[model samples]
Target: MPTARWRKSSYSGGQGGECVEVANVAAVIAVRDSKDPAGPKVTLTASGWCDLARRIKSGEHDLI
Candidate 1:
């Protein structure tokens, strides 16, 4: 497979705490930790990605 061109979130700070990188891998959205490029990844379909984004914006998964 070709290498994914990952991009970090614009909201991420330079100090890097916890950050994720996303890439478009054909029919799916690929996500990985920016601190661990060679680590595990999470893949989601287009619709699934949209749903997750919507839920996040709605604070459904807020930690506080």
Candidate 2:
């Protein structure tokens, strides 16, 4: 497989704080810490990615 082209969110701060990078790897969506490129990564299927995004947008994972 070709090297994944990771991209950070436009909303990410430039201060190098909490942030993540995402990439499209074949049939999966790859995610990793932006501060730790060589560290572990999470891979999710297309459908799973969509669900996760929806949940996030709906504040299902929010801590109040």
Candidate 3:
């Protein structure tokens, strides 16, 4: 894959604790910990990324 251009999540707090970074790479969305720029990362298909975002917005994974 080519070098990815990462951007910080808009939901990230200015204080910057537990932040996430994302990049668009071809047909996938690349994700990584903001604190670990050089660490292992995850890649998800565009559809999968959209599904995850929708679920998150709907609170599907919220702790009871």
TM-scores of the candidates are 0.90, 0.88, 0.83
Cα lDDT of all candidates, in order?
A: 0.89, 0.89, 0.87
Cα lDDT tens digits, model 2, 1-64, are 2499998888889875579888999999999998888889999999999999899889999998
Residue 17 error, candidate 2, Å: 3.4
For model 1, how does the per-residue alpha-carbon lDDT over 4-62 read when each residue is reduced to its tens digit?
99988889988775898889999999998988888899999999999999999999999
Which is better, 2 or 3, measured by TM-score?
2
Comparing 1 with 2 on TM-score, the higher-scoring candidate is 1
Per residue, candidate 3 scores C-alpha lDDT tens digits across 2-42 of 48999887779987668888899988999988887888889
Clashes of each: 0, 0, 0
- Which 10-residue window in model 3 sums to the lowest lDDT? 1-10
- Predicted model with the maximum TM-score: 1
State the displacement of the C-alpha of residue 46, model 2, in Å, after optimal TM-score superposition. 0.5
lDDT of 3 at 62: 85
